[model samples]
Target: MAAIQWTDVAQRLKWEATPEGYDRIRTVWLKHCDTELRQDMEGLLSTLTDDCVYTVLRTTATGATRQRWDGQEGARAFYTALFQAFPDQNWQPEAVVMGPQGVFSAVVLNARQVAPWAGIAPTGQTVSIRMFVYFIWAPDKGKFGGEVVYIAPIAE
Candidate 1:
């Protein structure tokens, strides 16, 4: 395979530049993001580094906002629980934009309520939710350490 350029990806994403030896950072970041957003939970779990940290900030039903996953194992457990909790949920990334620092240029996420999301029975609503995620990628760690919520909205 061709050599990867972490600097190029970082600049393109408008993050920050790192010294050498971290050139593979961007590869790790994208791979992880793609795996999760593509709903390949199994694929994502395998890519997680032992010391990796990932946080997901989201607004759940019952009008409660929560942040889950403090680290690699936390993330894995979160996804696992989520899948089991919402047994029939299907979350799809309708669109994505490359932003500075491994963030997105534009992020429009659409999720369908295939099963019970919260206390609410499956409305079969097929609701479309749009949100933006700002990413912070560290090359030394070879991971997207933190991702903040750039934007999200309450139900209309």
Candidate 2:
């Protein structure tokens, strides 16, 4: 493993130094994104390691909300809740970076509130939000070991 240079900025990942490294990261990232887009839970689960950790952080004008999910069962519950809240969701990647540690993506999410989200009742309104997601790669398992998400609604 090469020395990884990490930064707190969203554009931190930088694994373009080698073809094999780039391909490896890109493949896992694309598959993860594709599965999420398709709402294919099983497919997404396949890309994760058994002890994967998933977290979500949402910040609003009022305050911030954070949640975590551990392992396979937790991941399933997290996705289920997300789909229930935003039945129609789409992710448009604004930027993506690949590094020795993981893949980082900044995305714009367009979604419809069809059900309650974080205790807020459904208003059947369309919303656009900015989200930063990181998928940590586990070389030994050749899969993603963890994922972290940060989201904030885009003010109109």
Candidate 3:
């Protein structure tokens, strides 16, 4: 899989945000996404608060799996594992809603299964998974405090 085409995603995405919050989250989230695609760990961490929490929910045929990482250290560990598993991770967001509290996005996350992921064995095939992700925004701090991703893999 290739890196995300930010221009393409931006052109097609439908977005909305409160008058007061739009500018804040739009910049933060876009930078976060950009750094993520570049696989820049430090840049990625810069976009998040020091006390940030990251959570993932992967739904498979059998059941759903949940994982959570708290604080900067945990975030670093999570990203390290993620980059190792899927270096070319990408996402195409269809819609986004932002408010004073947080931002929610509906998107398709694409990545190659180069290693075991969410308990599934490696297939070395690109997979497009529908995901609803929520990003907690700390307006005062001007950074993301947390992120929650709910991934629903396509049924085979």
Candidate 4:
């Protein structure tokens, strides 16, 4: 397979903190993920720099799943499908943990059965999963460093 040019995800995601642009980025992320907002995400490539490598950590009481996105397209596709499938998705983030090089995040994922996810539709069933999502991002590289995900079932 041909390599995806560096310019692909690079130019899109700039690190400079702009009062309006950054706000827009946060809003887009929130709206796209929030069940109530249920909005279609656009220009996601611009959300991260080309060098950025997106990642997500999924942990459960039993085990965990770690994944890193290849680039802009990877992140975009994952987020799009994730939101679309679980329309009733909610995440409670306590705070953003910042590190010397990157940042970290802790969040709880509340995924409701509103539609078909992987051919599994809502039978009025619901699953509340508590997870810790860590995002290691870089200011200079204008990309994500890495991610750590942990999960456990929560009784709602």
Candidate 5:
């Protein structure tokens, strides 16, 4: 697969932040993931601001794909589809950092393809992929203002 065009994405998002801010936000992010794993939508939604934006960017040698969610409802729909696609989905954070632009997290997603995903039929095969997630903090709201996820398949 071709290398991910991270520079391009960064340009569009203008990612940056402070270390202290990143550390604090990382804690909230972990809680958010935990809530998601527990399938507690209300708790997960509590971690984000009302106007939060969630974006997913998937790129490969063939092409690139992008999806965006606008607010609480959008986030609900996004997570709903995700759980439907991988009912037993597990997210593991490999690394996390806060830069001047945003909080960046490297996570591994492990699950079985028991349901169709991105239009592909279920294979019942276990799959693992690495995702880079960037989050913008909302100090006033004490939650995240936005999140951008970059997903790529793990090399065999």
Candidate 6:
């Protein structure tokens, strides 16, 4: 994969360098992104730990709620459904802060709603969603522990 040109905010902040483990984490993360862009599930899963978990956080009229998928099987299922639903899904990173312990990023997600998502019927509309994603880094294992994502849909 080629180098990614992140958003202006990232360039201004000099995200290319800083955190002690930036290079290592960035390399792995880019690989994860590449695999996802190519819709390669096996390659994507290789970037994560065997027991990695994925959590999606949402806010509603009532309150805040979360949906979590545990273990490798769960990760597989979640990503499989996502890839199937949005075949052209892509991520445009706005900012990324890397640390020895973890990485946090703000991104704009672009996808077409070709299939139901979270029970919502497909509209076949291209949508851009702003999201904050946090990756738990297991330095000792040199792999990500899990991911926590906060989703915020961008109003058109």
Instruction: Give me the candidate number with maximum TM-score.
Output: 2
The residue-by-residue lDDT of candidate 1 on 1-156, one tens digit each, is 011257745455554455442345556656766776666786776555455444444555446544545666776776665454444444455555443345453455344455542233455555554556555554445556554553355467
The TM-score, computed over Cα atoms with residue i paired to residue i, of candidate 6 is: 0.80
Model 2: lDDT of residue 2: 18
Look at candidate 6 and give me any clashing residue pairs: none
Pairs clashing in candidate 1?
13-99, 13-100, 14-100, 14-101, 15-101, 97-105, 97-106, 98-105, 99-103
lDDT of 5 at 105: 87
Residue lDDT tens for model 5, 50-134: 8888888888888888778888898888778878878888788899876544467898988887876543457788788788987
Candidate 5 TM-score to native: 0.78
* Weakest ten-residue segment in model 5 by summed lDDT: 1-10
lDDT of 3: 0.77
Assess the local accuracy of residue 114 in candidate 3 as a C-alpha lDDT between 0 and 100. Answer: 82
Each candidate's TM vs. the true structure? 0.56, 0.82, 0.80, 0.55, 0.78, 0.80
Per-residue CA lDDT of candidate 2, range 12-75, in tens?
4333346777677788878987898789999989888898888877777888887788898988
Q: Is candidate 1 or candidate 5 better by TM-score?
A: 5
Write down the lDDT of every candidate, Cα atoms only. Answer: 0.52, 0.77, 0.77, 0.50, 0.76, 0.74
Query: In candidate 5, which residue ranges exceed 4 Å CA deviation?
Result: 1-24, 99-102, 118-121
Is candidate 3 or 4 superior in TM-score?
A: 3
> In candidate 2, what residue range of length 10 has the lowest lDDT sum?
1-10
Q: After superposition, how far is residue 87 of candidate 3 from its true place, in Å?
A: 1.7
Error at 119, model 6, angstroms: 5.4
